[model samples]
Target: MIKTSTQNELIQYVYDELAKNASEQLETAFMHDEELAESCSELLQIQNLLDNALKSPHKRAVQNILNYSKSLSLQS
Candidate 1:
């Protein structure tokens, strides 16, 4: 069973959002708490997938916007 402290620590650890000391503590807890480690791994995977998705061409249209703006500028 994972302790509440470990569960809470997972939130920051999974995303690498904790300070160095806290992150180290969380990693130690993760090594000892199977449930917490699994939860953190899942969250980390999901976050990584989401980050990759955001970087996909369909997810970001900045280039299209810039091209359109350039065309408009040329017309004006």
Candidate 2:
């Protein structure tokens, strides 16, 4: 069984977004807890899907910004 604290810590661990100590704790928990490991794996998949979705919108926004800057530079 995974402790509540360990399950909660998984949010950061899924993305490797935790500090060193917290990340280490997550790793230790995962090693000993099968349910937490499965949960973390699921969270990781969700994170990856979110990351992929964000990339397209981010690229579009960056391109828009670059186009706007180019237009402004031409005006000046």
Candidate 3:
């Protein structure tokens, strides 16, 4: 069973947002806690899926943004 604090800390560690010392503590916890380790594995899979799904916008979207910005500049 993962406590809320441990879960939050692990999530931050996954995103590389945790402090160094805290991250080391979480790493040590992961080594000893099977549930925490499994939870980390699951979080990693979710992050991988999110990364694939949220890739940069398509070329058309980029072009549309650039065109809109250029139009705004011209208007000003």
Ranking by TM-score: 3, 2, 1
Q: Which ten residues in a row have the lowest lDDT in candidate 2?
A: 51-60
Better of 1 and 3 by TM-score: 3
Q: Whose TM-score is greatest here?
A: 3
Task: Name the Cα RMSD for model 3.
Answer: 2.2
Per-model C-alpha lDDT, please? 0.78, 0.80, 0.92
Candidate 2 pairs with clashing backbones? none
Candidate 2, 1-76: lDDT as tens digits: 6678777678766756678998887788778788888898898898888888863457888899999999999999
Q: After superposition, how far is residue 69 of candidate 3 from its true place, in Å?
A: 4.6
What tens digits encode model 3's per-residue C-alpha lDDT throughout 1-76?
A: 7889989998898999999999998889888889999999999999999998977779999999999999999999
What lDDT tens digits, residue by residue, belong to model 1 across residues 13-62? 77677789988877787787787778888888998898888644663587
Candidate 1 vs 3: which has more lDDT:
3
What shift in Å separates residue 73 of candidate 3 from its native position after superposition? Answer: 6.9
> Model 1: residues >4 Å from true position, as ranges?
1-5, 55-76
Show model 2 residue runs off by greater than 4 Å: 54-67
- Give the clashing pairs for model 3: none
Per-residue error at 48 for model 3, in Å? Answer: 0.7
